[model samples]
Target chain A: MRRELTISDQRIDEQALGKGRAMSAGMGAAVYFVGVVRATEEGRPIAALEYEAFQPMAEHQFHLLFDQAETRWPLESVRLVHRLGRVAAGETALWMEVVAPHREEAFAACQFIVSEMKRVVPIWKKAFPLA
Target chain B: MPVSVLVLFCSDQAVSGCYKSAVQVRVHFYSYFKDLAGLAEVTESVAPGSRLEDFLQKLFLRFPKLAAMKKSALVAVGIDYQAGDYVLAEGDEVSLFPPVQGG
Candidate 1:
C-alpha cells in the first residue's frame, strides 16, 4: 500500500492530496478526507491552532493504522498528511485518502483511519483565541 | 509527603552515587505537557533496575501537570509503545503524549 506521513509548516496542498492515489483499473472507489482548522473552539472564537507531534512516534502509529486497515480490507493505497506549527483558521490541517475495490471497504477504512488517528495518534493541537 | 521531597529523593539516589548503575533516559514532552513543563525534553536519571512505574513516579513528582494527565497520556519507549510496567533501559528515548485531538 502507498502510505505517507507528511508534516509541513505551510498550508496543505489541496490539489496534491486530491491526486495522491494512482488510478488503478481494479479499484472502483476512492475516499478522501481533509480536516480544516475551523474558526471556533467550544463556542469560543479562535484565530488559529498550533499543532505539535512526536514525529517518530506519530509516524510509527500511522504505520500501525495502515497495517490494521489493510488487514481489514483489500486496499490499493493509503495516504495521510498532517500540518505542524501554526495553522490559521479555515486552513487545512489534515488529509486522508483511501482506495479500494468497492465503496463499502473504502468508506469503512476511511472512517476507521480518521477515528483511530484522533484516538491513538501522538499529535495534539491547542487553539488560540481571536484577539 | 510533599512533591519536592519525592523529587529530591529520586535525584539523590542518582546524585549520592549510591546507584552507581544509574543511567539517563531522555523524555520528550509534547502538547500541553510541553507548555506546562516549559521544556521539550528533560533528562531523567534512573537506576538500572528500575521499572517504568518507578521512573514515571519520579517524573510525575517533578512535573505535577503531567501527573494530572496520567489517565489520558500515552507513552512510548524508542519506536514502540510500552506499558507502564515495562522496564526501562539506559539511553531509552521515552516520550509522553497527551490525548490526541488531531484529525
Candidate 2:
C-alpha cells in the first residue's frame, strides 16, 4: 500500500505520531522529530508565535522531501506535520516521523528531511515575546 | 526596465515598513526581519544588473536590523541560495531566511 504524507495547522497529536510509529513496527525502525516553540527568544519571553507559509509551495516541498527520503532510504512510511497560525510558547511547531527497516537509514533520512524542510519550505515564524 | 521587487513583513507588528513597486524581481523576508518590518512582502524597483549583495546592502540601510543577521542569513533565488554576486534578473524570486532551528 502507498503511504500518504500528512500536513496540517492544528496541534500535533501524540497518538497520531504514535500511529505513524506503529505502522512501521513490523517494518523495522522509526525516526521522529518534534519541534517545540520555546518560551524565550533572544533572552526575551515569548508569549506566542505565529507561523505563516506559502501553503501551496510549502505542501509541494513537503511531498518532494518525502519522495527524496523514500528514494534515499529503505523507509516504509513518512509523516510530516507543520503548524500554521498562532502558537503559544512551548507548543509543537513541526513533527517529522520516518520509518525504515534499519535504524541507520531511518536516522539519517529523518535528519535529512528536517534539514531540507527548514532550508526549502516556504514557512516563516513570527514570535511575540513578552515585553 | 526597473526591477519589480516585493518585500514581505509581518502585517500585524511594526517591525518595519512595506514597499511595493512595479519591479521584475521579488524579495522575501522571514522571522525577526519580518517582525521588525511589520510586513510580509515588499516590492521595489532595482536597476537592472544590480548585484544581490548590493541590493542587500541597500536593504540594510533601509532596515538596520537586517545588518545584524547578514552574516548568518541565507538568500535564495527561486528556491535555491545564490552566491553573493548573483545578478538580479527579471522576474526572479528572492527569499531571505534567518537561521533555522528545527529538531
Candidate 3:
C-alpha cells in the first residue's frame, strides 16, 4: 500500500491529489481542505512564506493523527500533504482530505486531525516580507 | 535525582563516588527559536537523567531568549510531545520551538 500521509519540499502535484481521493463504494462523504499562504503576515506585505520542518518527526506525527482519527470515526480514506521550503502568497501550503461513511464523521475527523496537527506538529513558518 | 542538581555540577566527574554520568543531547531549534537561538541545532551537555521538561531551563544558559518563551514553547521527542517529567537520554533528538503549525 502507498503512504497516505506525507511531507514534501516540492509543490503538491497532480499525481498526489489523484491518489488521495479515490473512494470505494462503501464511502459516502469526503471533506477536502486547502490552506493557503496569505499575502501578508502581521498586517504587512510579504513576498512569500518559508516553511520548514523536522520531516521525519512531521511524518510520524501525521501517522499518529491518522491512527487517532481512524479509531474515533469510521474512516475510509485519508490523505494529508504539507509543503516545505518557500511557498508564495496565495499558494497552497497544506491540503487534506478525509473520507468516511457519513458527512458528520468526515467533518469531525478532519477538524480533529487539523487541530491536533497545529498543536503537536513540528513544523514552522517564516515570513520573508517584501524587500 | 532531578537533573537540576547534576546540572549545577556539570563540571564535576562523570560517576565518581558522589557523581553521575552526564549526557550530550542534540537539540534542534525552530521558528522564532532558531532566530533567538542564533543556530539551527547544537549538541548540549545534559545532566544525567534529565527529563525532557527540564530541557528548556537547561538550554537557557546558552540561549536566554528561548527560555523567555517557556510558557509557550513546544517540545517533542520525535513525534510525541514529551512532558517535563519524561526522562531523556543520550542520542535523543529533541525539537524545541514556539507553538507550531506543521505535519
| DockQ in order | 0.64, 0.17, 0.56
Query: What i-RMS does each candidate reach, in Å?
Result: 1.1, 3.4, 2.1
> Candidate 2: which stretches are off by over 4 Å?
A1-7, A20-26, A38-48, A54-57, A60-64, A115-131, B1-23
TM-score of chain A of 1: 0.95
True contacts kept of each: 0.82, 0.18, 0.74
Which digits, one per residue and each the tens of the lDDT, describe model 1 over residues A1-131?
77776866777887976755686899999999989899999999999999987777778888899999999999999988889999999998998889999999999999999999888788888899999
**Candidate 3, clashing residue pairs?**
B53-B84
lDDT of 1 at B52: 84
CA lDDT, candidate 2, residue A119? 73
Candidate 1 DockQ vs. native: 0.64
TM-score of every model versus the real structure:
0.87, 0.67, 0.85
TM-score of chain A of 3: 0.92
Q: Write the per-residue lDDT of candidate 3 for residues B5-24, one digit (tens) a residue.
A: 43243534654554654677
Q: What TM-score would you give candidate 3 relative to the actual structure?
A: 0.85
Worst 10 residues of 3 chain B by lDDT: B3-12
Error of 3 at B33 (Å): 1.0
DockQ-superior candidate, 1 or 2: 1
Chain A superposition TM-score per model: 0.95, 0.89, 0.92
Tell me the tens digit of each residue's lDDT in model 3 across A46-113: 99999988777778888888888888998988888899999999888888888888999999988998
